[model samples]
Target: MEGECIHIRRLTEGSMSYGNFYWEFIKTNTPVIVTGVSIKWECSNWLLKHGQENNIYSSEINFDYLKQQIGDRLVVVTKCSTHDESTVSVEMQFHEFLNYWRNQILSSKADVNNVTAPKILYLKDWHLKAQLPNYEFYKVPQYFASDWLNEYLEEHKLDDYRFVYMGPKNSWTPLHIDVFGSYSWSTNIYGRKKWILLPPGEQFKLLGPRGSLPCNIKEEMLIEKSVNFLIIYQHENETLFVPSGWYHQVLNVTDTISVNHNWFNGTNIKYIWCNITENLRKVMNEILEFRQYVNFKEDCQQILKCNFGLNISDFLEILCFIANSRLTLYMKRYRSKDMSGNRKSVNSHPDNFHIHYDLKSINMLSKFIAQDKIVFNCSTLYDRCMNLIDITQEIFLER
Candidate 1:
């Protein structure tokens, strides 16, 4: 029931190549803290230092100016938890949330072990990328840049998975998994956060009937030996990558602001596909009489599409999109006079490994998913995926 404790490590761009970045971290699905990221982002310095001297993260971000800039948009804020693992939230204009946020900062009782009055508030999942693209607050590091979810969403002209989070000390979100089993990365611009991360394959042991982790992560920490997890105290300007399927709880150790994105790429696509189909299958099996009706599986797929954002066919489309794009680029590269070299082990150049890895990985995934029972419901789309796979293999051999 227990797994190895997560390795606590840090890296800078100068420390390792992207090839090692993959084999050491991405391929192993481990969490790491990365630094020297070229995020020399002026937004962090500019916003953090509004006008007066700053506080957390040493930023001068002025309270009033920011309120004036983003106040009218509706924001979602949660009042401090009254029930275990269930915090109630309300939607109000951004300015209104900041007013309440200011009141919490003034009433903060951090010195007191427990302040029972005036519950704290947390503003979460603000779609900053869609609403404020010109901000250009940060750039994706090469280590985590192969993000297919955001890439696909952008291609379709939809809102991306990027989000901004802000909250005062004592605000927290309960333990939960990322949507669709996607990998996630979060970077703290200011203040620090305490993270409790549990590995995959162990969530069912902790999940309650409502499918959420219902116990206090702090309480669970008291018995950490019995329940293994990673305790990460993320600090200023540090980035944390959470691999697919990990369950995590985050608490603002100080007044804080951060940006995060959830993305599924070639590295974790199968995990994403499996999570969706398994959940859909569970819904169908739980309602047996419902299954006796005509086309029950397909009906369940429809419901899942509306709720979970994807089913088998849509998942295949993402794979094909990336595969074909990579194929096209590689063909161009192979035809060039520069690439007339012999094939070598994948442990070569950082960029070269990505090409070799992508070709083999995509071909394997396409073949495996094509044979899955869930693909039986949609013959035409599945056939197209196989054809795409064939094209991928053909182009790969031609190179």
Candidate 2:
């Protein structure tokens, strides 16, 4: 049986209750479901029928066949899935097929026998434009521009921070937060999606051991964990609101079609900017390391100055802030009790200093000018350090 739709009343009531109980929680981050948003299923069916009448099947067609019929064009994956039991399991680009049909008729290749056939039937492209190594020759269609979705975007005031994601069945969007400084809402229009969410404090455990930046979880691990949570929905159009700072992984349970919008109002603008600044710092560090090893300092410096318009020192400060924040958050979550003990034992400098020998702490300090600079007087930084000590003390005291 199809899943029940998430009604407006339920959303309003639930958000109100949840918003109050978790007022601090919702202010920082939360997730909610909204239903009866649009008639996406009807639109999906309409596109499918149009493809059949035009003798066009996107999955069974190749780029060569399309080029022969319609020249070059952008083909967006509107639906996909690995579950053969699901109706939308087969991935297809309806608009691409439609474009091919129209071009074929204009080019007088309308005869069914004359149309070029592909050797491989299922020619699916799963990579998004940004994910592609080279985006010059490829283009992604904007499924978010559908009339129904556009209307919702207008009502919700999210027209600016919109993006389209297309993936094959069973593909995973790894655990990460969004960029562009906005809270996001993702809706499943054509198939099922399973999501596993982690609160901010819990994020350290999953990422720290892996030695990964918050934005860069290994895709394979994300896919495995998300599939384990596999939630199925055969009907009812629904959207999931993902508040700022919530780490989540999504698995397209079937060949799926979905649209996502990210929006920043007065509430989340500061936090969103903080997230972007953190990401930029990570990217800069990677570039700097590459330049040092490759002896391309001059070339890299030019790119940094010309492209990013930032000098090395300014960039280094940002990097320091991001690294300190990550370490602070990690230690706070994992070693808070030790922090308290160190505070109490400050008189015994040598003994308390031994805590600095912890590899993670040492490594973090090594990256900065000195321990003092590394632990600068930012409240978030200071709280994280104390929290780390507290966590460590609890563990050792137990032992």
Candidate 3:
């Protein structure tokens, strides 16, 4: 069941708009290279300030300055070989991680036992943007700014999905999909990475008979050797837009650092709902003993809430937020006028994509909320949605 076609398209910067990105890559669930998006980022200059120009990408990225800025904040790190949650995490100061990153590959000495030592420190999932919202290193592209996950999370003072990844050469992540089946963008702020990506369902075929994907893509015991995967050698100042549900494994080609964000908007949120429901059903079936309860379905949904950070109520609330936001934006777009009171045409706004996407999303969410067999019912949710619809007609349609 390995895929036979592998493609990762490349697009240029300075001319690409959100419309171009949406229609081409987002709609198609395809990965693309966006060059020069981070050209003006201060992080790019920081990447160069610490090393020779020819090797700037692999340079230290002014680690001393970053160390001072972040101070002694402890970061979570994993051993590359132990990729599962069962893997123990070691928390160390930020300076220690950087010091180890600089020396992980370079340290060499004559060993008394003549045996090579393995470096297992892998800095993974450091939520830098959430911690430092005012960090002025780089700006997110307009195409990715309408992020519901992190925006909602940030607004509610919850943990966000924005993260920074740093690791020495040979440190690699196991193949996995992004959280909640969301699309992700990773920008190489310093150094290079080798990405191996498999589209949505192809990753399942690479799993062993026990039904887990290989922990390491380069493992000798890989279940399927011929699985078709796109290989990308990502360079500095470049961004990789990974579409939703794609399973990707990354290898640091140098002592590298990058910015990563996981997001899902109204257009592609159906995938997220489907992924969550599917997982919920699987877990429910696996825990059959819990079926004895009077509220089995609610129990399952609660289990999903604990494990996945989203319950049915949480899902509904997110839908309500997005629907309300779209209602406001659409009404604003509808009512825009000049000083002469003449209505303005909406073609000037790139956000015209919202109507089609938003309608489809609202309809889907509406159908789900209207389901009689749902886990729980909230009259307030239905009332809020109805009021928004009423306001939409009153504000946008009524002349």
Candidate 4:
């Protein structure tokens, strides 16, 4: 069977009014495909064949069985329902699965459990440790990492980023944005997938109780047209470049596999990191402030703005200043003399001013400041330090 043909168009000089058309898309928040570039087929085939041969039946797997199958280097996480009678299942990392199947034969233990229903699964970066299993199965990286993408990355000076993702079927990554401060182009090297994207300003409600780990919003709410941008495909060898700050959820439609590269060559890189750091602070504050509040989602959205700035890089230095100031305050509280040495003593204060920092975190903050990539005026940094110290002293004296 053949896939749908996508229109290809070369973006020549003065093709579309670059300023008007491009900026409009950013302003209106719409996704577009820049045609004319060729797609990669070899890498896609290699991935598909790898999955077909080594991917295990989701139903018949257990932690112990997988450990024996893949050996000790695997990181396995099992998601169980809150209800007692619910069935148990597991998801294994891609590298671990490959190590196990490469040396061993088909085992009888896999047949013991009736591996029936299919659940959401995710495998991250399976190819780093192993070469593409078979070239005939899917397109190779050489196809997509062509002159077009390479030239684009170079023109934008985005060569510093790394591409590290490997995974198999039944493993689905949670809905989230790309990491390491850049836009991402995710191409399906193996199977079909369903992608749901939430643009800036969309409110995605949380799935778990307030302050749960692996924070995720309900999938059902993501389907509403008013709240999400949805795309579904099968056996489609295409690349989708998602702009920075877009919230996305991906599901493997078959025993499929994929590879994605996140790059940070543009000004948007700094902004993306800023957005992530600010969001983390907001989440931590919400968890601390309203441990009792059930509607934490609404509260968080209220304070955040939809458009952080023109692009991620635009506000990189400023956001770094905010982040550094916050971290310094956290460190001062930990080193203060007034507080009892016990860590618990810091939390008993009525002002809710408790903060903590460790050596590794402090070192990282200092490095960012020293790089000058995140420049802060001397007065601003000094003011932040004094305020943090005063806040700590006040909290301790009140206690």
User: Native-vs-model 3 lDDT?
Assistant: 0.70
- In terms of TM-score, the best-performing candidate is 1
Higher-ranked by lDDT: 2 or 4: 2
lDDT of 4: 0.40
TM-score quality measure for candidate 1: 0.86
**Model 2, global lDDT:** 0.42
Rank by TM-score, descending? Answer: 1, 3, 4, 2
Which one wins by TM-score: 2 or 3?
3
List per-candidate RMSD values in Å: 3.8, 17.2, 4.5, 18.0
Candidate 3 matches the true fold with a TM-score of 0.84
- Tens digits of per-residue lDDT, candidate 1, 282-379, equal 76776667877888877887878887878766777777777777667776775542332233443355445555556666787878877877674578
Q: How far is 107's C-alpha from truth in model 1 (Å)?
A: 3.0
lDDT (CA) per prediction: 0.73, 0.42, 0.70, 0.40
TM-scores vs. true structure, each candidate: 0.86, 0.40, 0.84, 0.43
Where is model 4 more than 4 Å wrong at Cα?
1-29, 33-96, 99-121, 125-161, 164-168, 204-219, 223-226, 267-270, 276-399
Tens digits of per-residue lDDT, candidate 4, 1-399, equal 112222222232234443343334422435443332224443322322223335541221233533343344444433322222132445565455544433221332354463643332234533332332232333323212211223343344544233323333434556666653346666654455666655544533333366432324344544432344445353334555566667766655544544465543222433554655466455548566675687554444443334322222223333333334434754565444443424344234311121322222223333453344222334454344344344434433543
lDDT (10s digit) by residue, model 2, range 1-399: 112112211242224332232233334455656554444333233223224446633422232532443344444432322222122233445455544434543444455473653111122232332233243322112211112222333444432334544343465554566554346666555556777655454455555465864443433544543322212232225667666766666676544556566554324534543453454455557686574565454454455455544434333333334334434644565454453323234323322323332323323432332233323433444445454444433334453
- How far out, in Å, is residue 151 in model 1? 0.5
